[model samples]
Target: MSAVLELTGFVLTLGGWVVIGATLKNSYWKVSTVHGSVITSSSLYENLWHSCAEDSIGISNCRAFDTLLALPAYIQACRALMITSLILGMCGTLLTLLGLKCTQLGSNSENAKSKIAMLGGMVFILAGLSSMVAISWYAERITAQFFDSFYGGTKYELGYALYLGWAGSLLSILGGIFLTCSACKEKHRDYKYAATRQGKDARIYIKQSETVTSAKDYV
Candidate 1:
């Protein structure tokens, strides 16, 4: 049962990691709002790296951010966070694979494997949190600007990429929870078994001592 749970968690975490990658590559993190506009000739969309405009005829043009230093602090922060998340995810995946009971990569002891799995789960959770914060922060900024009555800038709405990021983050978090639980369960079982064996050994030693005492008395 623990093995199954571990495998399930691994799959979920891996899938979430892949989804996050897709989210990062996706271009539409935000799109220009069409609300209160009667005629829309073109649509503007942007991601962490670039902005794009699509005309009514479906022709689209894109331009990368000219300078990293000139970009908004939030954008730069988000980029860093997403990149960090990816790096952590990769490390977590490798650790998880090595720790899995079904794999032969790491130590043969279940205890060691369980510890590795737990560490991987923690890393996975951190990765998820990092991405979640980045995506939420970006969305919050967009929504704040959109609802501001005095704001003169173009209003943008949340796009598909944001949704993808949210989904991926959630999956990664859940997966991490499962992985942690499985590892804990295994560790608990091992401890229980060790305790039982120790108790049994003590009982056997007491019984042997009693027998020896009886033999000496009888002799």
Candidate 2:
């Protein structure tokens, strides 16, 4: 049962990591709103790296951000967080693979493997949290600007990439939780087995001592 849970959790974590990568590559983190626009001939969309505009004729053009320092603080921070999440996910995945019961890369001791698995789970959770914060922060900014009555700038709406990021983050978190639980269960089972064995050993020793005492008295 624990093995099954661990495998399931690994799958979820890997899938989430892949999804996060896709989210990062996706172009539409935010799209310009058409609510108050008089001209509907063009639509603007943007991601962390670039901005794009699509015409009514379905032709689209894109331009990468020219300068990193000139970008908004939020954009820079989101980039950092997403990159960090990816790095952590990579590390977690490697550790989990090494720690899995089905694998032989790590120490033969179950205790050691369990510890490694738990550590991997923790890293996965951190990765998920980082991505979650970045996505949520960007979304919050978009919503805030959208609802501001005094703001005259072009209002934007949440894009599909944000949804993707949310989904990925959630999956990663759940996977991490499952992995952690499975490792704990295995550790507890080992502890119980050890305790039971120790108790049996004590019982056998006491019985042998009693038999020896009886024999000496009889002699």
Alpha-carbon local distance difference test for all models: 0.94, 0.94
Clashing pairs in model 1, backbone N/Cα/C closer than 3 A: none
Work out the TM-score per prediction: 0.97, 0.98
For candidate 1, lDDT tens digit of each residue in 1-219? 999999999999998888888999999999999997665899999999999999999999999999999999999999999999999999999999989999999899899999999999989999999999999999999999999999887899999999999999988888888899999999999999999999999999999999999999999
The global Cα lDDT (0 to 1) of model 2 is 0.94
RMSD of each candidate relative to the true structure: 0.9, 0.9
Error of 1 at 91 (Å): 0.3
lDDT of 2 by residue, 1-219 (tens): 999999999999998998898999999999999898898899999999999999999999999999999999999999999999999999999999988999999798899999999999999999999999999999999999999999988899999999999999988988988899999999999999999999999999999999999999999
Off by over 4 Å in 1: none
